[model samples]
Target: MGQAFLPGIRYDKMGEALFCHGEHVEEPSQIRPALERAFKSAEEGKPAVVNVMVDPTLTNLGAISMAYAVLFGHVPYRDLTKYGKAMRRSFLGFAFPGFEKYGIPDAPWPDGWEPIPPEMWER
Candidate 1:
């Protein structure tokens, strides 16, 4: 979770593959938004990194497009939401039993923040 994959570099820290720009993603669909996002943050002078604790299968990719949100001023969040919905449906159809089936870990809600289960994740 502490490791960050910046745009335009490649590194590995603590079993996580950190990828930057110019690196090819095996699953472009998953990491594309984050790639774009990290670059946008750099361009907009907000240069930042998104620290995520996600499944090792995601590698450089995480659950949401946090990087892309920074890049396009978050205009893509709406689309990302839709994309997530569709993906959930696909997962349900395949009976993936949610991300827990993937052995993915979820971050605990911080003291000041609460976790709200998305309506769609429900049966």
Candidate 2:
């Protein structure tokens, strides 16, 4: 089999109206500045395209595996009701505990229901 190579394009030569077509900003804190710059350029008749780095939990395996564990005998389940409640919380709790900070409210569980602990993430 022959090797394959991808050709790269020079977006800079596209002129001011298409400025920053392939720009990258590494840090989350840098996103605001990058967006501001892009907006300013666009306001001045030059629109920019930026690719910002983000951690989207792309590799976190939780949902299906957890549900499976609960369904089978790998994990203990004394009370189906309580187990279901924790499983419900596990969907977001295990993967997105910090979601509340992003303005998306945490998943609401029944009152007095114990939340799935962080230890769940370990498995």
Candidate 3:
């Protein structure tokens, strides 16, 4: 809930390794540095988890919500610009067309993916 991350072998592997541990929380300052390291390490291979307590929440829209992620790729008519525009208009495409069909503004992610800091949206 404190950070968003794209999935990678390191994190994915961590997820698989921790299939048994319940849950984990990460301390702050370490997050950005950890993510940055993971980004670079992935170029070579998966990053290593030096600790046993942490559990990676690997987020892969393509994998977690494949059907919904594919919805964008399937839009045969819309050009790139329009699609990007529509997606940003809401918090990560919340309430945007097609996403509603994926079940937004509803049960899960209760805020409907509304941007965390609304100020970032002005640009």
TM-score of each: 0.21, 0.32, 0.23
TM-score of 2: 0.32
Give the CA lDDT, 0 to 100, for residue 24 in model 2.
Answer: 61
lDDT of 2 by residue, 90-114 (tens): 4535565554565533444332234
Instruction: Give the candidate order by descending lDDT.
Output: 2, 3, 1
Q: Could you arrange the candidates by TM-score from highest to lowest?
A: 2, 3, 1
lDDT of 1 by residue, 1-123 (tens): 222324444332321332322323445364657667767866875443443334332322343334422343333223333334333333332444454665533432222122323442332
> Among these predicted structures, which one has the highest TM-score?
2
lDDT of each: 0.38, 0.45, 0.38
Candidate 1 all-Cα RMSD: 15.6
Clash count, predicted structure 3: 0
lDDT of 3 by residue, 23-66 (tens): 22257656666565555655666443432233333322332242
**Model 2 misplaced stretches (Cα beyond 4 Å):** 1-22, 59-123
